[model samples]
Target: MAVAQPKIDLAESLLSRHAAPGPGARWAQEARAAAAARLRAMGAPVRRDEYWKYTDPARLTAAELAPAAPLEPEKEALYGDRAQLKLVFVDGVLDADASDALALDGLTVEPLARALATDIHWARDLYGVLEARGQDPVPRPLAALNTAVAGQGVAIRVSARVATPVTIVNRQRAADSDVVLHHLILLEDGAEMTLLEAGPAGARYNTCLEVDLGRGAQFHHVRTQGRDNERHAITHSFARLAAEASFKAFTLTVNGVLTRNESVIEFTGDDAKAHVAGAAAGDGRFHHDDTVFVTHDGVNCESRQVFKKVLRNGALGVFQGKILVRPGAQQTDGYQISQALLLDEDSQFLAKPELEIYADDVACSHGSTVGAIDEDAMFYLTSRGVSKPDAQDMLVLAFLDEAIQEIEDDALADGMRERLAGWLARRR
Candidate 1:
C-alpha cells in the first residue's frame, strides 16, 4: 500500500532535523534504515489514532520542543543510598566523569554507540529487534524514530546472577534540551539482574528500552520519572521472554505536563511470566497515560498488568491495556486492572481494558474503576483527630499501595512509598 502523503512528509521533516547513527556496523546501519522506513510508513501518532485518542500527540511530535525550566529536587536522589553501579546522563548525553565504571563482575555494560560500532556483538540479534516486533497490531512511530536516530544510551548483557543493581541516572541541565535514547538488555539463560532508572531526561524526551531474556532468566526493573512539572516525555519498553523466564517492571510517576508510557511483552516460551505495573499522581495541568499489550504465545504463560493513578484539580489520566492469547496458548493466565482515585470532581480518568482469547483452556480477566475518596472513611479519620489533608494523603497512599507492591525488591518499594509521601506532604 502506498504511504499517506501527510505521514511521509511528517517523517521526512522529523528525520531531516537529526543525523543518522554515524559509523556503525553494517547490520546496525541496516537496522536503523529499516526503522526509519517503518516510521515513514506508519507516520507519527495523532489524537485521531485509536490508542492515542485519549492523549494528544501534538506536543510530543511537534517540530520544536517548548522550553521547560528544570526543577531542583527538594529531597535526595532516589536509590542514592543503595549499593548499585550508577551511570549518569546529563541532558541525555552520557557523562563518564559523573558515572561509576561500567565494569561489573557478572555483567557487561557499554555505551550503545560503542556497542553498535562493533561488528561482532550479541546486541546485533536483540537491538531494535523487539521494538520492530512490537509494532504489529499497533504502530509506534516515536519508538521507531528513536531506534533510527538515537546515539546515546546503554547496552547491557548479563551472564550470571548480579547482586548489585544497575542504575541509570538522568539529569536535565538545559531548559530546552530535546533527547532521544535507546537501550538494550540481553540476559543469558539462568541469569538475573535488576535495573533502576531515575531523573527527568530532558524538556522533551523520547526513550526506548528493549530486553531479551533467555530461558530461565529473570529481570526486574523499577523506575521513577522526575517531578518536572513542565517536562514532556514518551517512553516505550519492549520485552521478549523465553521458556521459564520472568520479567517484572514497575514505575512511579509524580508530576509532568505530559507523560505516556507503553509496554509490550511477548511470551515465547511455556511457563514464562511477565508483570507490568505503575502508580501515578497528577495535579492541575498534568496528564499521564499507561498503555500495555501482553501476548501469550506459549502455553501456561502468566501475565499481569496493574496500574493506579491519583488525579486532582482537573488532571487527566488514561489507561489502555489488552491481553491476547494465541490459538495454541493453552492454560494461559492473564490479569489486568486499572483504577483511579479522583480527589476532586474536576479530575478525569479514562480506561480501556480488553481481552482477546483464542484458546479455550485459558483464564483471563480485566477491570477498571474510577472513584472519589471514601467520604465515610474520610469523616472517620478526621473525627479521630487526623487533619483533613493528612487523612486524604493516607487514603491516597493506601489506594496506590497495590501497584507499588508490585516491585519485587523491598528496599526499592520502601523508597517509592517514602517518595510518594514526600510529594503529598509538599503539596499539602
Candidate 2:
C-alpha cells in the first residue's frame, strides 16, 4: 500500500536526524533498513488511529522536544540497597564512571552499540526479531523507528540462574534532551534472570525492549518510572516465551505529563505462563496509558493482565488490553482486569478490555471499572478516630495493593509499597 505524503514526510524528518548505524554487520544493516521502511509505511500515530484515539500523539512525535526541568533526587533511589549489577545512562548516553563493571558471572553483557558492530554474535538473531513479530495485527510505528535509530542500550544473554539482578538506571541532565534506547535480552534453556529499570530517561524519551525466553527459562522484571512532572515518554516491551517458560513484569508509575507503555507477548511453547501488571497514580495535568496484547499459540498456556490507576484533580488514565487464543491453543487460561479510583468529579478513566478465543476449550475473561473511593469504608475509618487524610491514604494503598501483589519478589514489592505510600502522604 502507498503511504500518505504527510506520513512519509514525518518519517523522513525523524530519520534525517539519525543516520543508519555506521560500519555494522550485514544482518544489522538489513534489520535497520527494514525497520525504517516499516515505519514509513505505517506512519506516526495520530488521534484518528483506532489505538491512539484515547491519547494524543502530537507531543511525542513533534519535531522538537518540550523542555522539562529535572526533578530533585529522592533521598534514596529505588532498589538502591539491593545487591545487583548496574548500568547507568545519563541523558541517553552510557556513563561508565557511574556504572559497575559489565563483567558478571554466568552472563554476557555488552553495550548494544558493540553488539550491533560485531559480525558474529548471538544477539544477531534476536535483536529485531521479536519486535518485528510484534508488529503484526497492530501497527507500532514508534517501536519500528527505535529499532532503526536507537544506539544506546544494553544487550544481555543469560546462560544460567543468576542469583543477582541486573539494573538499568536512567538519569536526565539536560532539560531538552531527547533519548532513544533499545535493549535486547535472550535467555537460554533452564536459565533465570531478573531485570530492574528506574529513573526518568529524558524530556522526550522513546525506548523498546525485546526479550526471548527458551524452554524452561524464567524472566522477572520490575520497573519504576521516575517522577518528572513535565516529561513525555513512549515505551514498548516485546517478549516471546518457549515451552514451560515463565515471564512476569510489574511497573509503578507516579508522575509524568504524558506517558504510554505498550507490551506485546507471544507464547510459542506449551505450558508457558506470562503476567503483566502495573500501578499508576496521577494528579492534575497528568495522563497515563497502558496498552497490552497477549497472544496464545500453544496449548495449556496461561496469561494475566492486572492494572490499577488513581487519578485526581482532572488527571486522566487509559487502559487498552486484549487476549487472543488461537485455534490450537486449547486449555488456555487468560484473565484481565483494569480498574481506577477517581478522587474527585473531574478525574476520569477510560478502559477497553477484550478477549478473542478461537479455541472452544479456552477460558478467558476481562473486566474494567471506574469509580470513586468507597464512602462506607471512609466513614468506618473516620468513626474509629482516624484522621480523614490518614484514612483516605490507607484506603488508596489498599486499592493499589492488588496490582502490586503481582510482583514475585517480596523486597521489590515492599519497595514499591513504600514509594506509593510516600506519594500519597505528600499529597495529604
Candidate 3:
C-alpha cells in the first residue's frame, strides 16, 4: 500500500495563529479563515491553469514574505519629491505620524480596520461579491493569502456632490518579511474624486483595491510604482460602476524585479462607461505584465482600453485583455488595443486581446501589435541630424504619448513623461 501524505488544515492553522482580531479587525478574521479554507481546497496554481500559464506563480509564490521591517533612512528617501495626498503604511500598520494631508470637507480618509471596528457593513458588502461573477474554477492563492493576513489599509469616501480629489501614497520599507497586502476602498456617488497613488518602496509589496461608484459618480485614479530591482510587486484593482457612473485609471510602472497588475471593471447598471490606460517601461532583466478584464452585464455600456509598453535589453512584457458581454447586454460598445515596440531582438512581449459576446447588436473589437523600431521614422528624424539614441527615445515617447495625455492632471502627466524619457536615456 502507498504511504498516506500529510494534509494541512491551513484554515484552522491560520485562524488559530495568524488571525489578528481587534476592534478594527472585525470580520477580517472570519473572512480570512474562509479564504484560507478555499485556498486549501483548491491548492496552489500550477502550469496547467489557463490564466497563470505564461507567468509561473509556483516559483514566485513558493515562499510567503513576512511583514515588512521598519524603513531605513535611505528607504524613507524613496517617497521624497512627490506632490500628492499621501497615506503611508509601515509594515502592515498605517503610519499616522507620517501623513499631513487632512481630510477635506465632505471627504473621509480612514483606516480600513477603523471603519470595520465602528461599523462592519461596508467591509462585509465589498469583499466577497465579485468572486461570484468569474467562473474560473481555481481559487486565487495570492488573493487568499492576501485576505488571510491583510493588516490595516486605507479607505476613502466622498459625500454626494463633493468634487475634491484624494491621493493615497503607499510605501514599503526594506526588510526581509512575509508579503504585505494593501487593501483600499473608494466610494463616490454624485461626487467626483481623484486618487493619485505613489509607491516608491524598494521592498516586496502586494496591493489590492476595490472601488464602488454610485449613480453619476466620477473617478480619476492614477497609480505610480517605482521600486528597486530586488522588489516583487503585484496589484489588483476591482471596480463596480452603477448607471451613468464614469471610471478612469492611469498606471505607470518604472522599475522592479517583477511587477504584475490586474484591473477588472464590471458595468453593473446601464449606461456606465470606463476608460483605462497605462504605460510601463522596463529594461535589463526586469519583467512586467498588465492584465485586464472588462465585463458588461447591463445594456448600453461603453469601455475603452489602451496600453503601451517600452521594453529594452532582455526584459519581458505581457498584456492580456478580455472584454465580455453577457446575454442581455445590448448596445455594448467595447474596444481594446495593446501596442509595444521592442528596442532590440532580445526584448520580448506577449499580447492577447479576447472578446466574448452573446448579444448580436453589440460592437466589440480588439487589436494587438508588436514590432521593432520603425526605420522610416528613425531615418526621418536622423536626416534632421538627431542622434540615433535621441531618435529612438523620441519615437517611444510619441508612441506612448497618446495614452499619457489622456490623464487630465497636467502636472502628473508631464511628470510621467519626464520620467519615461529619463528611463530611456539611462538604458541607452
lDDT of 3 at 363: 92
- What is the Cα-based lDDT of residue 323 in candidate 3? 94
Tell me the TM-score of model 2: 0.98
Best by lDDT: 1
The lDDT, on a scale of 0 to 1, for candidate 2 is: 0.91
Evaluate model 3: give its lDDT: 0.70
Q: Is candidate 2 or candidate 3 better by lDDT?
A: 2
User: Which digits, one per residue and each the tens of the lDDT, describe model 1 over residues 1-428?
Assistant: 56567767888887777766697998899889999999988987777778999999989988888898876854325695778999998899999999999999899999999999999999899878999999999899899999889889999999999989999988888999999989999999999999999988899999999999999999999999857878799999999999999999999998989999999999999999999999999989999999999999999999999999999999999999999999999999999999999999999999999899999999999999999999999999999999999999999999999999999888899999999999999998
Q: Give the per-residue Cα lDDT of candidate 1 at 76.
A: 22
| TM-score for each of the candidates | 0.98, 0.98, 0.88
Candidate with more favorable, higher lDDT: 1 or 3: 1
lDDT value, candidate 1, whole model: 0.92
What are the Cα lDDT values of the candidates? 0.92, 0.91, 0.70
| Candidate 1 residue-pair clash tally | 0
Q: Is 1 or 2 the stronger prediction by lDDT?
A: 1
Q: Which has the higher TM-score value, candidate number 1 or candidate number 3?
A: 1
| Model 3 ranges with Cα > 4 A deviation | 1-26, 64-84, 131-139, 161-164, 200-202
